[model samples]
Target: MATVPFPFSPVSCAFSRQTGIRRSPLVLALLSSSALLFPVQVHAQQANAGAEATELTEIVVEGATDSASGPDKSIVAGRTLAGSKTDTAVEDISASVSVITQAEMERRGTQNLDEVLAYTSSVSADEYGSDDRYDWVRIRGFYQTSTGSYLDGLPMRISGFTGSRVEPYGLQRVEVLKGSTSTLFGLNAPGGLINSISKRPQAVKHGEVYTTLGDEHVEFGTDFGGPIDDQGIWSYRITSKWQDGNNGADHTEDDRFYIAPALTWAPTDATSLTLLPSYNKRDGNTAHGIPYGSGIDPKTYLGEPEFEAMDTIEKNIGYAFSHDFGNGLQFRQNARYTDLDLTYESVYGATADPSVSRSAWAVYGNSRRFVIDNQLQYDVSFGRFDSRSLAGMDFSYNDTDEHRVFGSASGINIYNPVYCGLSCLTLPAGYDWNQQETARGFYLQEELTFDDRWILTLGGRFDSVTTESAFPDSGLSYKADDEAFTKRIGLTYKVTDGLSVYGNYSESFQPISADRTSLVGTPKPQEGTQYEVGLKYRPANYDALFTLALFDLTQTNVPYNISTTTQSQIGETNVKGVELEGKFALTDQFNLTVAYSYWDAEIVEDGITGNQGNKPQLIPQQMASIWADYTLPGEGIFGDLTLGLGVRYTGASFADNENTLKIKPHTLVDAAVNYQIRDNVALAVNATNLFDTEYLSYVSIYDNTAFYGDGRAVRATLKYTW
Candidate 1:
């Protein structure tokens, strides 16, 4: 295909600063007061960007060789760039955004977000996605949750312990941005973030469904889609899933179910809109780490499962909306109303001593949250200079209403350890609690790109939050806090055709309610600053990209205690690190992606050890992964067969910041095979932890304190697409 470049001139919101034509002095609702909006721009491309247009491609999940079946290629459909607001190539975005294509998930038989990310370098998710309890992926060592997530540029979540599980079948792609992102974005954690582009109306008819299985009793899931119109203006997609499974080492079980629906509207050639409404219900046990004491050999439990002694449940409903007003103008609104009835109780040593583990009291609670967000933006033009600016406000008020219900029974009757297997009985009862926490925030951001080759970004935000507790007739105990404004700025320069260089400066402020007063003390805001430099390279001739980065960051004012524990420098620390990533299509039928990272963190100014040195618990100093697939086209009655392989390596880590406990590094591998049966149907098989490796995610004992990684297992999937 000859390169077709639709290059345009640079236009910006610059003169507006003096003319004040479209912006107001007061940013009414957005938590921030500034935003960078890019409403218009020109053409883009290249391997090394030598004037050749890049080929657009989609991943194959059904293992089909025909690259003709993808959302973007549909006769009638719109597109999105969730990683950036402008035409910035993925390799030039400054921030690292890991792209998880829909094909990648289907190819791996992924049932959850964690499964798809397992093979991604720089990403480590909770071992299983069987339920909502521990399905989180860590990027650069920070947990990616509601605080680190977005759907079509709108906030997708709000808390960590309680984040939403997006079904793999309902997304066009998953983009992960590493490092501080206070610019062009609002209130967020400095640990990095994830953006999920929802599946929308395709203006055409299209859809598919696939089911999978594995060890630990794992089973059930399907994803399907289609059009809702003939004028090519609307479309709809649905995803549903359920499973009963077990994680390795503790006799554990993963069980849960969920579903989601979405609608897309494209009224004309220059504009588009999307709406998504989702609901999920999950119930399952958590990872059973060995008790604090009573040393036991982790080897003896290698085949054991993390027992389901503890249980939990969750329910949520939410809607997301996004509109692109051609010419660099856009807007978004997200709202959610959630009511949860849950009960959590842990039997300390269910496997070691069922009686003692079961005897522990269970704590139960019910929680409710309501959140709404609105943001607006417009892109303008300037004669010699062009800038993408955004000015909008967001108000998120979470009324976390929680109350304790009662306590549950302990593990008893099974005094002999022999009964600890799946045969164990007489599990303990559960309990609940009642409490409430409220938080509100406002923010804004702005970005400027010169000649479409250089970008500068700036932004800030403020927040107010409170927490309260109520136990039956004891009235209530409440605490409130306010934080200072946080700021961030960044720069990116196109160094070569497919590569760019970038640097950033950012700050994060946290407000905690430890003072028991309206605003007694703010704990100095846990101030932090970072210095980083990186290279993003996407070869001009092939479908491949490589990235290298280094950074130094420091954090202070971390709380030391739960109540009245808001102290400054009690846990001050410094972190420095390096990272590398690459994605490429080896051939017309083969593709591969790889990533690696190294980090060094320590307490620089803390009470624990004046200047104690130790890596964060469960945080490996080194991590790497590779995923590749090969397919044979136009072959047998079975059709093209695609094979996939993945491997991961994790470095040493400690169980606590004190460095009292330690764990050595380990490696694991996975495999998969896919074959087409008919023009619209395909079959697949997937296996993880093929070797059933035994390694501890963290230290639990002197001789045997590690947890199991995963045991070997397999499942077959049948999928049909139109």
Candidate 2:
């Protein structure tokens, strides 16, 4: 967790909680409204800080033309808006963006966001081979949990039993916007999106504090920030962490606690405002796959170590605002509110027989969400052309309440036995229904730039959604609504100053579920379209960034389920891809990152004629990865060293859909090291499948289960900084 150089525009804020020591009345009204808005924003920043800094100093010099990394400071970034929400660059963005920073997650000691997108490219995070409790990714080949995910750019309300668990050291970067963004993010998942960002408030001061210990884990963390005075116009940050471990499966337990806090105030300098709060909790254990030629032992535990566990808690509070109204126009707003809670009980051992029978379940969930967005940007011109425009609106609401209780425990011995206890399973005296959803959107965009080497982009969006349900033990109620409109277009051609060439076309929509009407009729609305072409290279010398992309997407009305309450929008799917990425530093001590992807996802139209052209289970028609790091060059106590290495690959697919359960291909290797025992301490070590590779990270085929992929774990860290 390291960061600095933050001058606003990381738009978004969020957190709240209380349980055993008070707090939580919405975290005491968000800590009494941030202590009554912190002295009224420091008395309105000392009463208008000198007539708003002399009339906003020409609107801060026209907001420095929306600075797109003009004064180069590197961690590999040439500006971004996750591919055009404004701040362009990223080689003019025609698509396929991927950023990851915080110094590449502290030189790959990444811990989640699926190990910070293990080598990126078409991504395929935690493909379930262990490490459960959320964050399962998949991009170019679909399944981004739900609607692709986001944070600094809003949208992070998932459901099944609620979701969203971040804390990758409270992130400071992590983009990955790869295809069909629903024209400025409306209903998504054409395999793209994963924003994150957050880790704001900075005016120089920095910090870090860490502790981690391996093979069964243990953790502690802190990340600090600066200024609240000295007139840096108030700034602050805080990111916390605490963890307890054991994820080598057996008797699994993995606890956690996280916190995030932020603040910013800039009373002038064209205004700014920020505030964020967060809290997270977890106590994990869940993910009992196993039953693929079950020779058992993938860290076999088969559940039941005194009634297993999987608790959760989440809370967030947010804010983000911008101002700058000096002739170039600008106004922004962001919001957040979230709450989630879940409890799960387990009892697996689903197969390996023993007269087969061992499955108990329990889940009680709750969720609440509220989101918001508002934007308006301008930056116009005419005379050798130049422009940047945007308009926006967004809203979201959510409510989910769940309940499930099933029983039938006791059935051990896959090699060993276990004794039952929770009264041998039996729990159900209440709860079973609730759901609510709401959404809204309106978007517009335009980017245009001509003489400076052509760049054009267009966008559009309009959306509406609603969902409601209730069934308190069968008292029934339901509702639905829908609407959509999406579009996007792009073109780029810088062809110089570090290359660029691009093209794009996009659209996406998702609606359906209007009171669930479909037995082959009335529930239309999924939709997608894409076409892309790309090339970007930021070489000139080094500090690197490279890319190449080609794509074709397609999706349409997909829905299936034919009975038990009917569903059937028939189906359709397609994907065609290619991607290559690179991130290098090639010198100041070497660094590198590479990624590759292929993807061919099929199922082009199907109502079930043998699943029409199949090939879409776990998507992976190739993937690749590489990573490297180096540093060495000592002085004093022989310290200051660094090293890292990585490798990954995936291919092979079809775990069913009658594509005949094939699942093979695998590769893995990872390592790391760090030392620098003075200058504020350091010492690190990391490893992941450094050989104990077993493979099959996920394969279900309707619960014929599989999951394995995490072995040779190791960790060791100790850091302290200023």
Candidate 3:
């Protein structure tokens, strides 16, 4: 549909020098970092190495005393900014929050965002099976694909099929905040939201280069950053990656190219500004499914190789600025603008037959978005009482244009299919439309503490949202304007030196963005309410944190898709769940994590649909996972080895809202092994679904289609760092 040229030529030159062959722009961009950035020199051992090591140790000790560990680099993060726009201890937040650090992601060898969150509590990843197009995730029985994603505290909200994708390599840490959060974030889902912290400039110089090889996959990447001058007033960081591979399906393609360059200007410690800009391109195919009980190979390709395609392009520029006025008061602002385009086409079986009945479809969409948030915080103390007050405002705007087409494809026998190419497929124009939305919110919050043992928090926000949609072919247009106010209150009491109990009540509001005529009539904004209580404990003798939480969350005026072009907002749902999560560093070389979740979710009210008291589709009521990593003492040969293991369990779920079909439960195992080849070189191998388990990841009774879970996957990586 739409195209943009590569911004740099060094990427192509460097790639050609390494591979000895010319390739697409994607491959060229992957290799360009070395040419643009200064190269690192490796030194050999010298006779005075022992003396140099002693001197280095002293420097490290001095640096450690001057600065504390940041949450992005620690395995067990203790502080987070997602809960309150300010840095606060996780145990005192009065709500459930989970953080996945960069070190943890490396240990697990996560390849995508879904895998990065596979072991999180109250999260369901890969709900639609092995799809390379998007990361399908749900939190607490509620889908969050359209509204629950954020980057650096700014919303990455999506409309229709125009969504943004994140590159895990460019992230420092991922934080999950559970329950309603509209009081501070403006608009979101009731279940939760995900915030990804971007990798920024570091005071210390660091650089790494890595290559990975796996089944039908090859990749190369590099990340490096440091001070730009001797005074250290300016610093810069750059990250890039390129991959060419395929998913579990046969005759499919999965290729991507991504790069992010960041710079920070901190003239003084009190004021700082950072600019972040990135570009990403993806080339893949749409997901395909077979009929239930078909006994067909899961990797079978049902679409025409020449006619099937899915490509997306995204570009972004953003900045974060903050300043301290020197008196217990601070000001901060964050903003981002994004442009995204997508082109997708697919052909799949339309009926359960040995000679498949196939249908063809295509969609082309483009979206542009801009979001900004500004905050002011004041901290002061009076006698035995302390207070931290926060006031902020945020604005978000999105514009989207989309076109769809559908047609019929010639039938082919599943047992022995023959290739017909593009001549066998035909598609006609279907729907063409444009939509735009704008939202503005203002919020205020206050946190009070008494005697350093009891804490109270109160927050409220008022939001105004406007949406407009137009169909060009039909000459029809509709507009809606809505306003809402949401509030949150919480209290926490310290029971012991390292234990605390907390309770909270919060609310959320979301405006509908679909066509009014296609819907029942005028649709009202969805509202959500939640009541939660939780316990948090951090051991005094060990580096560990444990949490237990129970919550009751409800959402009214929920919308459901009646067809590809129509929807209705006549549903109300409720979910009551318990979640337990723990992270422990048992010893100097051992780490363990455990998580479990149980949900009782039901459709409480439905007007148009007669089946009301049923469980929502594709939501597992029970899920659990555990991971452990251990490394040997690095004293001699074979001492630099490390091992990791994990297991995940997902309980059964219904295939549809009517609950007529049940999908069986499944459990999968993952493992990793790593060895330090040299002081600056390492090798690692990781495997997921080690047993090659075969089970259903999703099923849709309405379409009579089923998708199989991913099979065994293995990857080996070699990395060099300085």
The candidate scoring highest on TM-score is 3
Inter-residue clash pairs, candidate 2: 13-318, 14-277, 14-317, 15-277, 15-278, 15-316, 15-317
Ranking by TM-score: 3, 1, 2
lDDT of all predictions: 0.53, 0.73, 0.77
| Residue 633 lDDT in candidate 3 | 53
Native-referenced Cα lDDT, model 3: 0.77
lDDT measured at residue 646 in model 3 versus the true structure, 0 to 100? 85
- Residue by residue across 374-436, what tens digits does model 1's lDDT show? 666667768655666655555544433333222223443322334344443344332222445
Clashes of 2: 7
Q: TM-score of the candidate numbered 2?
A: 0.33
Q: List the residue pairs that clash in candidate 3.
A: 11-32
Write the residue-wise lDDT of candidate 2 on 213-285 in tens digits: 9867889998877787887898888888999887786688777899888899997799989898788897887
Report how far residue 448 has shifted in candidate 1, in Å. 1.8
Model 1 clash tally, residue pairs: 71
Decoy 3 TM-score against native: 0.89
TM-score for each of the candidates: 0.79, 0.33, 0.89
